[model samples]
Target: MSSYAAVLRTPHACRAFAVGLLGRLSYGVVPLALVLAVKEGSGSYAVAGSVMALFGVSGVLLSPVRAGLVDRYGPRRALVPMAGGYAALLVVIAGVCLRGGASGVELCVLAGAAGTCTPPLGPTMRALWSELLPDRRMLETAYSLDGVCEELLFVGGPLLVGALVQYAHPATAIALGAALVLAGTVGMTGSPAVRGMGGGEQAERDGARGAWGAPWRPALVAAGVGVGLGGVDLLVIAFADGQGRPSVVPWLLAALSVGSTVGGLVNGAVRWGGSARGRLAPLAAGLAGALALAGFVPDPYLMAVALALAGLFVAPALTTAYLYADELATPGTRTRAGAWVNTAVNAGSSGSSAAVGLVLGQLPLALCFVLAGVPALGSALAVRASRGARAGVPRPESVTRVDPREPRSTAGR
Candidate 1:
């Protein structure tokens, strides 16, 4: 608690953390909101899934490009327009769906457009964190807290989306999420804390764009994590449907988030001496195993428990993956480096959605769970080839200097 407090003591830190959370809330809520809206409009989960699938693919293609812009031009110059543009897209999407004006082709195009426009706030916000706080322990704590905050968002986001979709409309939830993104980005980029920060140096920016200069390992591992997430999330929803209690879906997801939140808190608070890379694979394997086992559990309540167990290492694994990205990437590409992980996640989302959708239509749910875990395990293995586990967290570059003056202690920036 003290460490957490210490991290948030400065106005800079507090604002960065808050803004990150606000921006990411959209990420947490968007999938369900979009899915339900599309489903209600088209009367087919397949169409909904297809729209989201296309969105994921577009996101994957756009993450690196947008992140590169952030690295080169700075987050404020790069993201503010992005945030607003994405919000506008969401509104358009909602309107189209509500009016039933879009054909399959149009929906696919809109989904792609939305994905391409979607702000990569998660990575950019973390880059801001790296800028605001350069201390090692505090950085760890900040990262963990970020992860924990995301867990908390996931816990609430689904329920919020579900209720809105049921009561008002899916468009309402998505529009609200869009508002959060716009507000968060404007607030974050406009803040003094973020204003002081620069993008990467020219050389680092140049290298980020160069072929063979990418952070391939972290991207690969992140992709695996995405695959795991896509599979596990859909399976859980399936499990609830299978049990004839779709309303319990949020509760089950909340359990998983609780476990992940606990793990993230512990990982940050307890500073044991080990490379961040060392924990990546085993933790991922554990999460994968837990995911697979959960599918076999007959009861929905038991399945929730199983998911909780599986999610225990999730935040830790993800925290380490980012740390590894930091370690592996070139000096100037903070946002771009981490953005690859986001790309991988989007890729996994697209791939897994397609695969899981197929499994849901053709095969048993149990098989879907088993297949989902395999990609993560494979991605973990890929991490090994990239000096993973054996590598330590990256040291800050000597050239990247912090501001001379310190921030005032305050909850509000």
Candidate 2:
């Protein structure tokens, strides 16, 4: 009968909360910033979309390498430099855009740089959660809370940035975003939870070679979910444009975000006694069907409703994926496992954005929605296949385990 509030009072929990806020806030501005920059600098929707797509591409490409760095050097060692570099890159991007004469290629390159150097916030925060929460149920609740925050960012970030860009200036929004990221990242890094990570020199040496054992199957399956959802976002925007209601695109996307937020909240509140894999198939199936229906809906309002329904499964599916990942990751490499999951998500989304953008140009928006569902269906199938193959595998609680060499708390023991 341990109280959640008691756990929350711990330094680790406090750090996790701070890191979560910073990470979500940083991500929230991304889509809005991309749209504003492209519209102002390139003056074309297509170009703007492409620039937005590059943000994902950059994250996808760099995440694994960054994860490896974290595994080798620890979160504090990796995050400190990365956050500083990210802030600098954001400033550079702002400067370039402000100059008003940069070419599309130049902007794209800068965009790529920003994306590549983007702080590994998601991965780092998830790592902090694993280190902080040792109990299974508590860890699950923590991740659910994280998911809810993500939903809030999606709901609020775009609207905030969009308004700023439309009313004030894009630079103003970008500047504010950069400042937030700087402050949040720095503060999180200084916390006891982050500083306490990766203490054993032997484990650190072993982890440097990427020795963290991780289940590739579930990670890959989760990547499909990311790709599918990322494509859905693009489709929403494209659908809005096709219907000549571009102004409504953010709201439409927010519908999905709101649904996800609700779903995460519910998941955190409810206790389910079953396999994570047991929940996977049904949720994936529901998500795929919802996404498919979204494509077929003719009315924008109906489409929004469909998207909201589709989003209901997002956090559950992702949470299951993280659980699967935890089951497979080895000691001293839990953070890398989290990073891999994030990388897969970002990579899938990045690839989908580029592919879906092309498809949207040629096909109808409805068709794009249908196409986007393919990845979700594929993920469902993959999870189903894995469940069949690995029947009755005991799930691990979380990624991190205490080292015997280090002083152990009575609670941890």
Question: Which candidate leads the pack in TM-score?
Answer: 1
For model 1 the local lDDT of residue 39 reads 81
lDDT against the true structure, each candidate: 0.75, 0.70
- Encode model 1's per-residue lDDT on 1-413: one tens digit a residue: 88789778755668766876888889888888988788877777778878988887787777878887777677788898888888998888888778863567677788888889888788877777666665656777878888788778866788788777677878888888889899888887877777634454553545546623357766677778778787776788888888899998878877887888888999889875665566777777787788788878999889889878877877887877776676665445667778887677767766887789777847788878878888778877776555423243455423233552443221211
TM-score (C-alpha, index-matched) for candidate 1: 0.83
lDDT of 2 by residue, 152-242 (tens): 7766787788787777658667777777777777777777666556536634654755564445666776777787887877788777877
Candidate 2: deviation at residue 345, Å? 2.1
Q: Model 2, 132: alpha-carbon shift in Å?
A: 1.3
Q: What is the lDDT of residue 10 in candidate 2?
A: 52
Instruction: Give the clashing residue pairs of candidate 1, or none.
Output: none
By summed lDDT, the worst window of 10 consecutive residues in model 2 runs over 404-413
Off by over 4 Å in 1: 38-49, 98-104, 165-169, 200-213, 237-251, 292-302, 357-370, 385-393, 396-401, 404-413
- Candidate 2's displacement at residue 128, Å, is 1.4
